[model samples]
Target: MTELTGTSTGQPPTVDLGPYADALTHNPHPVYARLLEKSPIHRATQPDGTETWLILGHPEAKEALSNPSALSSDPANATPQWRARYLGDPNARELPQGKSMINADSPDHARLRKPVQRAFTPRRINALRGTVEEHADQLLQGLPSDAAFDVIDDFVAPLTLGMICTILAIPDLDRDRVRGWADRIGFPTSAEDVTAARHELIPYTDQLIADQRIHPGQGLLSELIEATDDGQMTPTELRATIFLLLNAGHETVISLLASTVFCLLSHPDQFAALRDSPTLADQAIDEALRFQPPAISAPPRFAREDCTIGSTTIPGDGSLVTVVLSSANRDPREFTHPHSFDITRPPGELLSFSHGVHFCLGWSLARLEAGIALPALLNRFPDLAPAAELSALKWRSGPIVRRLEHVPCKSGARSSAAPPHNN
Candidate 1:
């Protein structure tokens, strides 16, 4: 509760995200560390006059998140602007609040997550390991031999976009559109860009939802649809759940995988060290998530009753809790040497996914994807180095995360990182 070095009470911060978007597109560490230590819970004012509490401290973040009474992830009474634009209109009977798994409570959450869980079982993921590797290989093969390429475009983006299509049974989805939507959503250009992507994606998803019902197959969406027809969930419930699956499960992996690779490439010795011990790649993924988590902030939370997070007392019912996820990932109260990227760092301390029932359900999927991709990439291009001016590289300055705009690197480029790989 001590005042960190340079924080001064000024205007409350809004989720305008122009700066955050830029930082993410560039590098956001120094800013995030500053915010976390000094202002664990800074006051922010949004353009809509909506005030937000930015929980930047790691311990404070975990406390705020686990406090069920204080943070409500549901959008039942969300701002009209958010409801209409993101969740769809309720009064208009278009996209109602109770239509999805995300907006559901405990019993509902269990019910919705249960069936989806069955489809995304560990066995299912393990089975896809080879396919995932092949997918990575294909993307790598497409890159010009011994040429500089944008890692985001040439590899990470396609693997994720294609993977999502595989999960949804959308065999013929416009790969370009899928990649575009996921990228824009992950590191949006502006607020308008975020809004417009949503508007476009909704109809596209709606159409897909319709097709899944009629011509269902062996994908997550199709499986959910099968569950719905079996009276496991209502049709309306099915569409929203599918939407959540697509939206939540898509770009997060891309951002995480892309960000982790960018981290490795930035620190060539570290990259080479890991290449020498490839299994460390998984731990590196965890470390990268802790060191530079993609989901920069928590989903919106409104107090259901009253609560106290640490010494600060938050008033009842109307309070909006903003979980600074990156802060928690680096909270000294939680991790040993919060800033250092220790791949073998104990998992119990990291909250990059989260810490409760509301924790990321797709965490396994994210880990699996990163585990397969990271080592495989380095194993393939051990001598890789940035072809672009990494010093000139920037992060998108948004509340969401720290992510690179693009990672342009020279494949097979000689480096002092490590000995050339078998590839």
Candidate 2:
């Protein structure tokens, strides 16, 4: 175990988070709070033994995310040792060609994101309201009204997966296989397993794009293919973009839905508040995002040059850097009663969707889905509550995203007009 040093004041010592990895995976709030009391910028050692910096303060995270000149998103900007240990050596591993917008900076990020932005416009996302509602209604209708069921498997996962698949125009027959590959790639048992999954997915993505090329459909993939023809994006870029969309598009929303439900069920007052006033759905979503963001940290950014987030100066020699989104969202300096889960809490500087150039592209769509689903679920089952103990609920272990494995929920007779039972 790494030595724990430093206090809430003065220059804090560099702490290794390796020991708290499990606890952080299960319940990160307490650990994050303890760290925040020490320093906004803390030096940390990665599992691979590489030194890194974690930015935990709201203002500091925003600054680090906003300044791409000092911190580069491209893996190429990483030091050779850090890259080799984490991502493997360039020569040894043949990485997929082209860069997804998430990994690109400046002009490239802008260019890649612009074409997709049109597809996610207010009008476009709003048009999916019917689809979102329809899916939520259909899924809820299928659930046993008075029995324990996995909210994730029976409702949330399918709702989100369907929306993303519909957007990508993936064939109904291939959706399950695609989702399986995506889950494997996103949450692998080991580096080797993730590598195998990526290898399998890359060829499938190439073929998917090729099919879109020959037989254009109404999907975004076809539009992206057209964009490729206009020289806005390349063949490899199209494949990478599709892969990113398929995985990130659904996975984050799943996390959002699960986390939101967990938060609400754990706090019956808030859940009842949302149940009583459906209009607070949006506010509830915002509060849930702030209280427990889907992604714990943004993807690691490399230091292009020496950068100082607070008093801590990150070295210029391609040091790895991560902006802790969950930490920043809960920063006392940013919000009143940062630890409290209040749906009525006004929206503020929440870093859930992140900031600056690398902001999530499908944020509108995500909000649209959650805004509809949350209210619908509560209305359909007014007496909904978690079947299992909230404290003992398990979360998936990973570095970037925080996800619940399952949300075993029990509900009463379906009745939209019924008042929630006080327990």
Candidate 3:
């Protein structure tokens, strides 16, 4: 284990985050809290030898993101040597294409995100109300009230995938394919698997875009492809759009849902309180989001131009700065009782979904899924409880998405609603 050499004061010892990797995967709050007290930005070395400036303070993280000039989202700044040093050897799939919306800054990101943004606009997403709710109900339909269930495997993952599938009107997508892509993308053990999945998905999305082009559907993919405007998305961009929608669509929501349920199931009072006060779901989700963010931190960002975070000025184009959201959510400067999960919180303090121009575009959809699925799940399994030992359950590992491998649970009270799959 990495030694905790300093107290909640002084220049904390430069800690190696690897030993705590297990705790980080399952529950990172303790480590996050510890890091926040001493310094918001700490130098950390990974087992892979990559170094990062981990920004845990809320203000610092926001600054790091908002100051695009100082920090670039471009992966191009990452030298081929560095890229190979990290994800290149994962040996799972090939490394993600070097430049996507996530990697590009300014004109590129704006160009890429613009047309697709129209489809995700509040009104457009609001129009999806019925489809979203129907899928929520459908997911609830097959869940067995008295059986043991893995929420990640059987529920959350399916709900997110189905929602994205609907958005793309992908009629023939096998759930297995979606799951495999997720596993490959999220857990990049080897570069081969990562590259293979990334490339494979392009063709998969290409085929969907082609079908949508011929027979446009009521879904967003077709809408984005055929969007009428001066700033239209090219076929390549359309493919990227679908890829982003599919990959980003469900993964975090699944994490948020499963994490929230775990929190509620463990804390019975909160569960009962939520049941009694339906309005609390909004805050409950926010608190859960802050407390157990699905993605602890985003990839290291580089400077496109000169920028500063506090007193430190970053040079133009290639300075690496990471916004460690996990730490930020617990930053004492912004949150009170940051260690505890309280549903009744003032919203602005949390940055789990991020903030500013790069704020997650899928925020509305992710929240809606959680807002619907959780209440429905609880209503069905009123007496649901963890079926497996907390210490025994596995937490999925990655620098990208963090979640449980399985949330095995014994279903409680029978739901009057149709089983999740039946719907």
Candidate 4:
């Protein structure tokens, strides 16, 4: 492990974060806390040997995320060296494959996001409460009564994927393929792998959009296609938009569901609290999000010009600055008892879903799914507990998202007598 050479009161150490990348994936709070205490902003070398700035303070992270003038989301704006080292062949471009709303800076971002924003409004998401409930119930009903099952594969993944597919009108037959592509995109081993996955997925989305053109449906994909017809967006933009929605919609929820369940199961007292007061489900989900956010950090934000965050000066020479959402959510200055997980931690703003114009478009939908699915799962299997030791569980190895390979657990069929509250 790379150790910080300086004390918290001294100059910030130039640490190589590459060595601690695995630790970040497994459990980042301790590492983040240590880094934050030493320096809220530190210059670190990534595993890939690329240098970047990591913002670990709550105030700085929020400012970096919401500051449009100082930072640009577009990779093309990055310094050639920074882009080539991190993204490979900085000049070779075809809009960089997965260039969607999340990556596009203003004007383009505003244009791309405006079309689909209506589909994710509070009113629209709330309408799907019934659908989310039915899917959660059905997934719980299918769990094997006599065998231990992986909560991620048998429950969370399917439930989240189903909800996203339903919202996007993805045909059932395409779901497995979509999931495979999404997995590769989220956790690619190499740049070539990501490019190849994007290559495969873009054409698939193109066909989906083409199909929607001929026969429109009530899903967001069909709605975006209609926008394309009105000249609001091009075919490429439409495909990219749909790709973003599908991956973002499902993957984040999968992490949220799995982590929320893992947290509850690991902390039985908290689980009992939730079961006793089902109304705490939403609060519990928020706490889980703060405790173990799906996306550990926002995508790297390139400095548009020389900008200062806190006491650190970030040069404008294409510096890639990443706001560590996981760190910010646990900042002691912001949240009381930052390390402890309290479902009733008092509702407050969290950086898990990000902030500013680039905030997650699917935030409402994700919250709704967690609120319904979590309570339902716990209530159905009142004695649900981890079959595997928490230390033994395999966690996904990626910088962007934190998730378990599988959450193996005993279904607790014998204790399904009745939950404390099954509302």
Candidate 5:
């Protein structure tokens, strides 16, 4: 383990993360590099004045994520003061939203993750390739020939949203509303906006769950509903699990698609490589995930007991710790030329979707979507390039997820010539 020194009090030095939050949003690599260089772990203050332990090194992050006993996923295990300080309203009585597998531990996590895990298996995702490809082509076909299109609005958002909705069997009429709720929740907005999105989404999800229970269909949601019927989960757990899948499923893909295009377009050589050898699509997607992960950090984990992460000790009193996945993916100790965006780089582990028990449930689906969507888009528009300069792009402002506000690209007339290979 890498030793990380702290203050005289044994607590890591306090750094205000607020000042760098905007910079972190726009392009976090530099800020992350600085933090990692100083120390892989730091006690940082969030914009809202909440204190948290931020882990930046690849090894330390893996340690924190894989150790569930010391670092509990249950927010309910956190101290009342910690909850009140960070989450607000500690006394608020509500159903266990935190009981979802993403936020659960041990027996609860296993029970919640088991029922629907089969739906996201490699076999199931492979079966959905046709549907994913069909949707990708449909979205690509709609692009205008004469002008620049916002990839976020025109392509990634709709493609990912539509795919998840189809998989979950969400009604078409309700998708727009669901998208609105997802947008408000996923991006950085006012606290009121977040609360409002949750308010709208919870009741909507409840109704969806109720409907699934009554009239089971052919999707993962229906499968989970059956699990609920069989005493595998509670109504609240069902609702929360569905909500997690929907929110995580679409949003992460949105970021992946946008970031993949942005990265590829910026590196024309790699883009050409992928375009030339379409077989490299899988590697390209992995590189994209490593280079610019959608989720910059994992959800907060609470320390269940006095635990030592590296050489630094975290008190057991429900202290919060967040693993910076973005940083870990770029750690030089783990990857060769970590800053370079090389699609052909040897495959390796990535903290982007996290590791251990809480590893992303929808990873196969995410990979499948990117594998299909990227090559199709490039194949259709060989001359596709960024409509605006990188400096002009606006990134979403949030600590957890990193994404551009829009990726405007000018798809010039389709190239009749064969795809060019890197010279």
Candidate 6:
């Protein structure tokens, strides 16, 4: 067993991330590196007061994530205090939006995932290539030829929003409402805010499902509705599925597109390299996902049985455990020059989309968007650059997701550096 770091009070070693705001916002690799060196596992208390065991090492995280028999995603397996603190309600058994594949264990997860999986087949996703390109082109055309604009709000978000909406067949008018709910839930400052945003989103999702039943559309939702009718899924599961798609569907892609642009711009040499060789766009996207993942950690998994990660044994009786993807992806043992943003590096083990059965379903879609959006923007503008110093740009302060609030950039002749816009 590794010698645990100790505190003066003689309690177990604990890491509170709240104190490291600046490091987390600007760059969190150094802090994570120090923690990984000490031990792969550490005890920590979340801002909401939920105690959790964090898996930091690359191998340790893989072991924990792959062992479904030992680690469960159901909150029912979580400690009472963890459940109470995490949900902000002592009586709450599930998240405000209810159970979905991302938080389900075993048979339930498999059943829920099957139908959605069938709907997102390669053919289905690949067919959307035309739509993705069209959206990117339309957004790029609107950019001022020689001025600063937010890559996030003006381009990435709308393109992602359009893609997800088109896939789910969400109406044009309702698209903004869905985006608004996703924004609030994705970057929530408190458990209460998440709860409120989810509560608002649920009814909206339910209504969409209801509408689909009456007038079947050509989108994935209509297919999922059929699955429900065939006894493949329950009504509650249908609602939960749509809710998950709407929320996670676009948000992850937004993070991917925006973060890739920001990372390349920050490393001018790499940006130039990518421009010189357009085929490297795919490699660049993968590197961006590794260097600055959209998500900070996977949903907390509870110990269903006594499980040993590295030298630490997590109790069998419902203990909260979180796999820190950001840390694991940067573990020095896992990659060469783990902290540097090198787009040409060969892809290997990456936890950015997580591992095991819960790996992100929309990963391919996100890559496709980036493949189209990045090259399209660059090819058109050919001289797009950051308008503000990378440090001057801001990231939303949140626990689960690390997304830029906005990415200000200059196009054409406006590539000169300037102060950050207040937006």
Q: Stretches of candidate 4 above 4 Å error?
A: 1-13, 85-87, 93-95, 413-423
On lDDT, the candidate that comes out on top is 6
Q: Which pairs clash in model 5? A: 305-316
After the best TM-score superposition of candidate 6, give how far the Cα of residue 95 lies from its true spot, in angstroms: 1.9
lDDT of 4 by residue, 1-423 (tens): 467545475545667877777676677788879888877899887767777789999999998887877888888788788666556676743244556788788888998999889998999999999999999999999997678988889988999999888988888998899999999888888878887887888788888877877888878887888888899888788878888877777889989988898777766678888878888888889999998899989977888798888888787877888899999998988999988878988876799999999898888889999888888888777778777666667778554787888988886532222222100
lDDT of 3: 0.72
Off by over 4 Å in 6: 1-12, 397-399, 412-423
- Candidate 3 lDDT by residue in tens digits, 80-121: 555565555423222353344666678878877776677778
lDDT of candidate 5 over 1-423, digit per residue (tens): 123334697565687767766666777788778888888888887657777898999999999998999998888777777666435568632323446888888998999999979898888899999998888899989997679899889988888999999988899898889888878878747766676677778888988887877888888898888888899999788888888877888888989988888887777778788878888888888998999999989987888899998988889988888899989999998998988889999988899989999988888888888888888888778789777775567878454677878988887633233322210
Candidate 2 residues 1-423, lDDT tens each? Answer: 357666565545668777776767787787777888877888776544567788999999999999998999877788887656556574332145458788887788888888888899899999999999999999999999768998888899899999998998888888888889878877777877776787789888898888877888987888898898999987887787888898889888888988888878767778778777888889988998998788989988989898777778787888889899999999999999888889999779889999998888889999999988888888877788777767767888554777888989887532233222210
Instruction: For each candidate, give its TM-score against the true structure.
Output: 0.84, 0.93, 0.88, 0.93, 0.92, 0.93
Q: What is residue 388's positional error in candidate 5, in angstroms?
A: 1.6
Distance from true location, Cα of 46 in model 6, Å: 3.0
**What is the TM-score of candidate 4?**
0.93
C-alpha-based local distance difference test score of model 6? 0.83
Winner on TM-score between 3 and 4 is 4
The C-alpha lDDT values of all candidates are: 0.68, 0.82, 0.72, 0.82, 0.81, 0.83
Better of 3 and 5 by TM-score: 5
TM-score of 1: 0.84
Q: Model 5: how far is 123 from its true place, Å?
A: 1.8
Give residue 244's error in model 1 in angstroms.
Answer: 2.2
- RMSD (CA, Å), each prediction: 5.0, 4.1, 5.7, 4.3, 4.3, 3.2
Model 2 has a clash total of 0
Tell me which of candidates 5 and 6 scores higher on lDDT: 6
Q: How well does candidate 2 score on lDDT at residue 279?
A: 86
Among all windows of 10 consecutive residues in model 4, the one with the lowest summed lDDT is 414-423
